[model samples]
Target: MGAEAILEKIRKNAEEEAAALAKQGEEKAEAAAGKIRADAEAEAAAILGNARQRAEELEKRERLMAGLQIRKNTLAARRAVMDEAFSLAGEQLADLPKERWEALITRLLLEAAETGAEIMEVPAADREKYEWTPEGNLPIIGEKSFFKRLNAALKESGREGKLTLADAPANVTGGFRLMGPVYDVDASFDALLSQAREDWEQEIYRILYPKDE
Candidate 1:
């Protein structure tokens, strides 16, 4: 009712309104800060999870590559061993004794004689190394005499036995060749060993790398 009292009442009401506004502003600020903090925490967790997943994938890929490299190296080493084994076989066959060499050739000719009329060609090395006859025995053409003997052997095996000799030396290391009209039989030691290597690879592998038994 008094002017002073009315002014004081208005002042108190204004003070209360200002305090309420201040409290509301502080609460809103706190809520916004809490939301920002939660968002930041979630983003950090997501980044950490993604990093861990990428690391695991990279580690798995490295392990697979490492295994593949080891297998590749192992295969290369095994191939080297097989190659050496065949090389040694060729050497041994080439170094057979004279009697054994002749016997082997005779056997090969007998086995390979489809029609024994195929032209027989000797390797340059064989022509040089073969002991065709007894030293100083009788036949002046010792090579010819040896060929006649081969013909006899062929005839005994129920073949044509008329294989003519070739003028040029055969393209071979050891053993002999029989050239027919259609195809030729390569009885060269190198050729025989090459074929044998293919046929015996599995057997050789079994010997080289045995199972648990």
Candidate 2:
């Protein structure tokens, strides 16, 4: 072959080899870039999904806390109202009329004195109003009295009854305490009201805190 022809053929072979290498490199780079982009898009979608789930969870937790706070506040308010009502009722009961007070005491005494053998203990504040005689009879005004009422109640229950007032006054608010040989019965207004409140707490709560419309 001639020298110029050999040199031209060598140049043409070199150029073709270089072009083929460049095309292969470009194809590899494009494939790598496409894979990288796809991975990045998938990561972004996962991150967005996680963020949404966390946001929903946080919202639900906040709602639950808010509901609990509301319920706590409502219960506190209801308790306050019931306490105030009971305090007001106590004041009214303490300030009851003399006639009503006497009637209540009489009824309590009648209920308490079952056998009439028990001693009826009265408060110092009530010593002047209700006086007991030595014969175990208490005079109301002149003839009609608590002894007759107690006797009538006991006889109706088919039991002989006898009641005498205690010389020592009780420390109580309005009601009396009946002392038998074995056990003593507390019929005081404070004690009675406390028991009543315990028994009727649910009913009282319902009345105080009705469901909202």
Ten residues in a row with the worst lDDT in model 2?
134-143
lDDT of 1 by residue, 68-159 (tens): 99989987988899999888878888888867877888899888878878998888766644324656465343654667778888888888
User: How does model 1 fare in lDDT?
Assistant: 0.82
**Candidate 2 per-residue C-alpha lDDT over 23-103 given as tens digits, one digit per residue, 9 for 90 to 100:** 999999999999999999999999999999999999999999999999999889888887787777777777888678767
TM-scores, all candidates, are 0.77, 0.67
Native-to-model Cα distance after best TM-score fit, residue 24 in candidate 2, in Å = 4.9
Q: Whole-model lDDT for model 2 versus the true structure?
A: 0.76
Every candidate's lDDT: 0.82, 0.76
Off by over 4 Å in 2: 1-28, 132-158, 167-169, 209-213
Best by TM-score: 1
Tell me the lDDT of model 1 at 149.
74
Backbone collisions counted per model: 0, 3
Backbone clash total for model 2 is 3
Per-residue error for 46 in candidate 2, Å, reads 3.0
TM-score, model 1 to reference: 0.77
